[model samples]
Target: MDSPFTSKLGTNYCPTAEDAVEIQAFLAQPLRQMECLDRKIAELQHALNKLLEEREGLGSIVQSHEALLSPIRRMPADMMQEIFLACLPTHRNCVMDAREAPLLLGRICSAWRALSLATPRLWASLHIVDRGEPPQRTGCGRCPSMARTGWSVPTIPFAAI
Candidate 1:
């Protein structure tokens, strides 16, 4: 596979017509080999892309099935309600902020929202801060009216408390 041009490479020597013909013949085999390599590389790249797509599809399936086995989804409603109740502040009444529980519990999922709202005890006590603004009486439809005297006077039933 040696070329007559090999010894003459990197020199200013001009090739004769016969030397030029020999150089072209010498290059043919390597050029065909390079073309074969390029085709193989393209085929391997297509196979790699297909494998990556299959892996991504399998990952999505695994994630969805994993959600079905979550412990929270299996817990009984009564137990979940107790956990929600425990999240309430013991030192003081629950605040209207979403950062705290009761309100935070309602934001978790639809089932929890229904349970938290259905549980009247969770909305039993609310510490209202009068920031010189009129109070908004928007709680579980059972929220008593706020007296218009700039004071939050909740007349919640004793049973709800």
Candidate 2:
């Protein structure tokens, strides 16, 4: 672009009315171009945000579908039962805490909960820490059959000590 002013632009230079008008006109084109570019950038940023949200939704669906194909989900009920039994403490009876095997196993999923509840051996032994409130019924609530009929594995034996 050619200079609109005849003299070189410096700190000491003072603009006349003509020079001021010319300066405004010279800056107008570039300023409008900058405003147009800003609008375009905002539109692109909005589009990018929408695309990112769609990607997140698709990713969540993929993860949930993948969980259905897990190897543990395919294992036979008997094998899962043995795995649950193995998770029990050998030295002492299982506690009521949700962190340990018997309680934790049931909390895993609906299939595991059904398996754990059906397998009486998992509820065979329990260490009840009485807080010195009146004793409730002495039966395993997890397995209603065991609680009512007292049907459990003879080898493991039920204990509430």
Candidate 2 C-alpha lDDT tens digits along 111-131: 888888888888777655544
Cα lDDT listed for each candidate? 0.74, 0.77
Those runs of model 2 whose alpha carbons end farther than 4 Å from true positions after fitting are 1-31, 136-150, 153-161
Name the candidate that leads on TM-score.
2
lDDT of 1 by residue, 1-161 (tens): 77767789899999999988988888999999999999999999999999999999999999999999999999998888788889988887766688897778888889898888766667666665544433355343423213211333432322212
Q: Can you give the TM-score per candidate against the true fold?
A: 0.59, 0.68
Error at 110, model 2, angstroms = 0.8
Looking at model 1, the pairs that clash are none
lDDT of 2: 0.77
Lowest summed lDDT across 10 adjacent residues in model 1 is found at 142-151
RMSD of 2: 5.4
